[model samples]
Target: PSSGNKAERFGTASVAVLVRHKPGRAYISPDHPIAQEGAGVVLTCSAKPPGWPVPQYRWFREIETGDIKSSVL
Candidate 1:
């Protein structure tokens, strides 16, 4: 079959596999801090992406006893 006919046949098919290629891993830092823990301390994380779901974020603080305090938002 000619290439044109094959293309037409595929187009007429009921089901098709459409592959969408999208970029990943976007990171940004705002000029102003989102929050302040103590005096002269600030924390922030930012990013922008199209058609992306809400990301899972985690924050960790290391203690003197080699233990980690984790906070997830």
Candidate 2:
């Protein structure tokens, strides 16, 4: 729905947000210094303070040309 649509009858709602929980560094599993050519790879990415509202993972690989290819999940 567009913001222009009125919801006056809906009244107001209270919300609370906490941002004090500092997140720990992220880590990757099955880290390979150099991956084999044409080999299927499966890597798991995770971060500390794991809970609901999980963080999205973006996989990136650097080709020989020093160019990064990224895929979003």
Runs of candidate 2 exceeding 4 Å displacement: 1-22, 31-35, 70-73
lDDT of 1 by residue, 26-58 (tens): 554556556656655445544454223445446
lDDT (Cα atoms) of all candidates against the true structure: 0.53, 0.69
> What are the runs in model 1 whose C-alpha is more than 4 Å off?
1-23, 26-40, 48-51, 70-73
Models 1 onward score TM values of 0.34, 0.49
Quantify how close model 1 is to the true structure by its C-alpha RMSD in Å.
Answer: 8.7
- In terms of lDDT, the best-performing candidate is 2
Report the lDDT tens digits of candidate 2 across residue range 1-73: 6878765565678898855554467888867645689987677888788544567777776879998766533
For model 2, the run of ten residues with the poorest summed lDDT? 17-26
Q: For model 2, what is the C-alpha lDDT against the true structure?
A: 0.69
